[model samples]
Target chain A: MQKISPLRSSIEAFNKFKAARLNKADKAQKTNQQSQTNPFGITFKGTVIQMDVFEKAEKVNENTQKAISLKEKMQNTGKLLASAWVGTINKFSSLKTNAIAFGNKIKDSTIAAAKKIRDFGNTKVEFDVFKYNVSRLQNKPVSELRTMLSNELQGVTNE
Target chain B: MNNKRVKNIIEALGKHKDEESIEVLNELGTNCPIDEIREMTSKALIRKNTHRALELMIVNKGKGINDLSARVAMCAINELLALKDKQEAIKILDDTINMHSEKEVQDTARSVKALMSFSS
Candidate 1:
């Protein structure tokens, strides 16, 4: 109700607003501190039970690592078996091809040897003697030739 | 013993000029078990161009053109046709055709004579 200037009254209202905001900020900080110290404000008085939770977690981690290593080893073994199987098959194929080649070589050599033997038989000394005897008979006496030829023919017929 | 040797012997006998050679050819060459020997013998006889060889070829049974084997028969006929002096062969063929007892031999001689006339 007292008379006041407009600027002075606005400044007084701003100061009152600042003081109320400061009071609210102080009360929020005190409540935050109280929650950080003890939120429910209750205490446990009996003997506390301790569990080895971190140890169990560490054991779980070690088991997971062991399982991962075993899986990797199994994969490696499977790859090794597949490669060995392929290598064995390739070896067998090469062996079979070599065997066939060797067999063919033996067969060809045998045939060549047989042909050489036949040629040798054809050019023997006895065959030349038979030829010479046939040519020599042309100059012999007719009666002697006839008797010789008759005997030869008789032998041939007997055979 | 060897067939090649026997064949050469037959060829040698064919060149001999003696009459006894004919008898050997008739006995061994014509009557041999082998057909090739018989064929060679017939050709040899024709090459001799003698009356006796002509008689054997034209008048004999199962000899020369009348041979049992058709290949031998054909070879003998071919030999007769190929003769440079066919006078003696023609005469014997005429005798066989007119006077031979066997009708088969007479017919064969007649056919051969006809072929000879055509060739000349």
Candidate 2:
């Protein structure tokens, strides 16, 4: 029987997870398009404007917070994966049963952490599109946009 | 406390756009001592009736009123003007151009008039 390697399975799972998250972001952007209207009344062909200014500001803040938390988790997970790899190399055969089980657990968790980081990247792409649309549609000056964004951030935090 | 109450009332009236709300908003917008309250009333007035809001905004466009408030008022007028009949829109813009001293408001009213002419 050909053995399915744990590393290969984890890699496949991670790729599938990343693809799902990217698809979710695309779907969210498509759904939000109905509410967004071009201020000039001329819709640019194929230009997607999903989030309004306030929502865009809030989403950016949320994505930043999530990314920071995931970074911390990934660092911790990296340490655990490294220790598990060392154990597999040094303690293999002597504690083969226990080492493989521990190594698989570490691999699962590391893939989960990697999926979270990729999800954050997907959300960041949505946020970038939102920012571009706000600039294009509203035609607000940077100072005004900054002031409006700060006001929205404050409103979100206060709630 | 009283100012907040007035602000809340203005918001409710503006949202409802009742038959008599325009008059009340116009009075408050024009005579209210507090700038914040006055601006609130001006916005409410604009929301309640852009035509009436235009008259009130033009009346308030003089020295003491806030420039921001007048700008908002002008924007509302321009939008409502588009929906109004051509003659009525022309009359309103002519009156605004003649009676209003604010160059920005006058320029906008003129442009609105020209746009109406070109569209018609």
TM-score of chain B of each: 0.95, 0.53
lDDT string, candidate 2, B1-120, tens digits: 334334444565555434445555554444644455556655655444456655665444541122355554454545444453455446767897798777877876677667767777
Candidate whose lDDT is highest = 1
lDDT for position A36 in model 1 = 55
User: A1-159, model 1: which lDDT tens digit per residue?
Assistant: 988999999999999999999999999887666555454434447422233322455454788899999999999999999999999999999999999999999999999999999998897556546543756877777787777667777787787
What class would a CAPRI assessor give candidate 2's docking?
incorrect
Residues A53-75, model 2: lDDT tens digits: 42545344788889998999999
Q: Tell me each candidate's RMSD, in Å, in order.
A: 20.9, 39.3
* DockQ values, each candidate: 0.31, 0.02
DockQ of 1: 0.31
Counting only residues 3 or more apart in sequence or on different chains, how many pairs clash (N, Cα, C under 3 Å) in candidate 2? 0
Top candidate (TM-score)? 1
> Which residue pairs clash within candidate 2?
none
Winning model by DockQ:
1
RMSD versus native structure for model 2: 39.3
